[model samples]
Target chain A: MATKIDEEQLMNDMLCRVKAVNNMPHDIRATLLDFKVDGYKVGKVRPGIAEMLCNMKTSVFELKQEDDSKKKSYLTLTSDAGTSSEERTKAVGTVMNQLRDEGFVKGWRDELFPVSENFYSPPVFLMERAAVTVLGVLEYGVHINGIVQESRQDEPKMWIGRRSATKSKFPGMLDHIVAGGQPSGISLIDNVVKECEEEAGIEESIVRAGVQSVGAISYENWDPKSDKLTRAVQFTYDLYLPPDFEPKPVDGEVQGFMLWTMDQVKESMAMDYADPIKPNCYVVIIDYLIRTGQISPDSNGFLDILRELRSGDCQ
Target chain B: MATKIDEEQLMNDMLCRVKAVNNMPHDIRATLLDFKVDGYKVGKVRPGIAEMLCNMKTSVFELKQEDDSKKKSYLTLTSDAGTSSEERTKAVGTVMNQLRDEGFVKGWRDELFPVSENFYSPPVFLMERAAVTVLGVLEYGVHINGIVQESRQDEPKMWIGRRSATKSKFPGMLDHIVAGGQPSGISLIDNVVKECEEEAGIEESIVRAGVQSVGAISYENWDPKSDKLTRAVQFTYDLYLPPDFEPKPVDGEVQGFMLWTMDQVKESMAMDYADPIKPNCYVVIIDYLIRTGQISPDSNGFLDILRELRSGDCQ
Candidate 1:
């Protein structure tokens, strides 16, 4: 006889993996700097990154005293209120590119993400996708669960992707069929359609017709080693795939795709489960189960996990 | 031009109805008393009601000093640690019945609700259903969305009921097909099965087979005039009904049942929409929409409303 799964604990474990602040030492946590722009908090950075920014001797950075007693200062973009988004973007980009040159930032994706209050809001500025993480900037992305349901009566099967081992971040980890960062230029739905075609080789027509914008999950990822205090919002969608539809790796982002049942997905979510799913992908999948009632109200950890799912700064 | 519905604003309006504390005056909010039992907080009460309990001069309650400057006191159930649930219930019942006789509490249901940490935990004690509201006790219930779907291709239609005008709470307001309080003795699924039979004329077998425990929504309702500071969790279920399955109102708790299209359901959730749905029912439906993708990630108020949906003390 096997022991029953404590999904609540499993979810908490998953939560701790992404929202790493929970397990971080107090000293490391204490040294985290708030990244602000035009008086709006957009992200955070580690003390080392903050110190580097403070020493930049450039008009783009300003270290302001946030607390006198703690001798703590916050790293703020010197972009003033009423500055044009373009100017703000250029100012931030110059500093970010400098950090990249100094080897302080890694995984330099030339892509840019809107630094805004939320997913749909106009960007206060756009920062390079890779540099954004190091600055602990709020990042937004779209993740689609490409699911196959033979009929409405049957349990839906999800298409999971294994990221390319050579890729920069979470490489070779299991991922969604179509998941991509919400770059500054594209609409959320457009990002979905683009990622669908690029990552999973799904046509835009099939995606437009089948994709349903489901919900969003927000979480803060405090990885001191990565210099990331990232608060992220993943706008989630579900696309019902035909039984014959199979996801293939179009871009090298994914190595392969496999369709798994709800139970199989849950099994993978277990902390000790083999062939690990990407940490945040686990968050998205858990949310999907909650919506579909596979992980339901009767479950011991339902409410606890539900609250923790949005445990990050959403805006 | 037809103005678009501000679902977020609409949700906020609905939330204000149930989580009444937001619109309450500073004085009233200040006078609110915490209700604790055996060192665990389980409910709250307004000062007038708090004073009444203090004057009752019964061993059932103790009015203890909390904040001297604010002259604030918390009303605690005097049931000691290690007290048997049976003894705790009897002692509290005496205070509750006395409060009922004095015209402080009304709508006596002769029903009891378990006072626990969450839905599944063993209750510290059982409380009278009606008095639970006055004490602002943590409440739990099950609400089922009865929907008619002709086929997988068609949008599901909800079986919405008009509450009986004679009902004590939310009289004549719109409600779910099957909704009921989680009584002390019944399992959640059993309560759903029972409510289905009594409210919708649905059989136990049909309910057992059909009810999918989707999720739960928690909210706080503070109505000063009503003397309610209720923090409630409604465990939600979605039951698919065949086209021929017309919900006949078995009990007079409902005036009538009408199957509404998804659009109609959304219209009813609007603050200005005619025939307002029950306040917390609005919370549940919004959640359902979020899950089903009717209220997508792009909705301006999506995250705002989602966060506010669980704006109550869930545990």
Candidate 2:
């Protein structure tokens, strides 16, 4: 009946509205436009837009303008039934509360800013970096912790989530569990410890003993919204575990967690993965672990950078 | 005064029209649309529309019901400004007569089509494969030949046309005459010698020694046209010559040609050359020569791919 809407088109339209409202200046217009274009959207939850809004809100607090001190929380109630009044109002209320508590939406009003949700559409065969983007964007704020299982006769193994098919943007996927959504500038080491306890049901003391090293992941993707596709930037961090660490799924979010040798991970990834987001994270994590002698990519033709990355062994 | 026309918008309009007219299939639509979005205008010529018309004509011919007896010609007419009408008509008649004599444009009158006069905007820079398409669509029937200048330490320097400032698509640029074009494939090797004679004004018996290699270059810029960009695929070959291969400017197409030592060419390209195109073409040629041991990239840090290709190298 209606034209099948595209994520890009929807974003372009929303950005045009923002421009119209602000009488958008050229430079600011470019940045906001970029965020909308490159931002991650899940139903009404746009991670990029949300991240920008959070940044803007934080900046407002820092500026300490006179108007900001007396900010009032804008709240509205909505039903969960098939009525706009209920669900929409509830969604706004949830955001308002989270923002006010986080100190971002002190004076923000509750308004129905219709968001066009984008579903995950991974490439037919995802490379490492692309896999990371898919996962990071889809599960923007989830925290995860995982263990690296090593054996003397074969490549090291790692335990991680077989993400819930219902919640997975990329269904039937498995990847390491690592911390996500700690406050932007907080120490990653602390966040990983907390994330392990919460995400994998491991205690902080156990996490402290198991935790190994911390490294970061960065990615670039073509974003048509900004008309500068190649320069779009996204980043992530990984938390590793020692050879003895074991993991158990703590909540409903994880469908199942698997203990996979490096070769198994590579082989399974090649078969099931279609985005670079998860593999990119694994590449960084595995590369770090292997380089440190915790694992080896070439032992069984698994963790080698040339094999895993260059030769597209996963594919 | 009319509003400034956005080249992107104009290209989009043209692409939409083409798609609608030909009922372009989905696969082709995606590729063509990608091109329209990424490309930019390279140049405009009086016979500018010839390229577009030729593409549209061929595609239409393909889409039409099967007609094996159909024939077509892609031709451009040029004459001195004061040529008589009869002479112009006679020229067209002679070409038509030749086509009939050759049996390439004879059987089906209704299906026989030629590139009649048409309007064309300058070639736009798309962020995709523009140059290759130009070769495929407009220059398909043309043949190309490659040649390399012999080491000329003992020969006299030559001059050809200075890079055409007004006529060149990429104005104020100079590039190596990598290959020369011919009307028929059979005479391509001869055309190489012919091009060296005309462009470099060298009459040496250029020998096609051996096939060195072939490579491709892809470059796209977002800020310039914000749409189209060019990707050039070059076929390079090495040629040998007598030690006394003297060179000089032989035609008006090129401003001047000169014989220079490797050091001199590098210095001229890096510091003395005034045209932008010359440097791009020179850099590639110099890099190739250096890698092949004909020159050096380290002497003055000039003509080095490592230096030139690194992000922010010039900056």
Best by TM-score: 1
Off by over 4 Å in 1: A1-36, A39-41, A44-55, A59-76, A79-82, A224-227, B1-34, B44-56, B63-75, B79-82
Worst 10 residues of 2 chain B by lDDT: B111-120
Assess each prediction's global lDDT (C-alpha) against the native. 0.74, 0.33
Model 1 chain A worst lDDT run, 10 consecutive residues = A16-25
| Predicted candidate 1 versus true structure: per-residue lDDT over A44-162, tens digit per residue | 77877777776775547778876557767787866442388888888778878887887877788888778875555688888788777667777778889888885556889999899
lDDT of 1 at B114: 88
Cand. 2 Cα-lDDT: 0.33
Each prediction's total of clashing residue pairs, residues at least 3 apart in sequence or on different chains, is 3, 65
User: How displaced is residue A12 in candidate 2, in Å?
Assistant: 35
Question: How is the predicted docking of candidate 2 categorized under the CAPRI scheme?
Answer: incorrect
True contacts kept of each: 0.53, 0.00
lDDT of 2 by residue, B1-315 (tens): 224443334323322322221232333223321111112222211122233423442221111111235332232234421144344334434443443454433332322111111112222211111222221222211111133344322222212124545543444455454343323223334555566676665554443432232221112221122222222222233343334544455665556544444443333432323532332344344324432333321122221122222111100
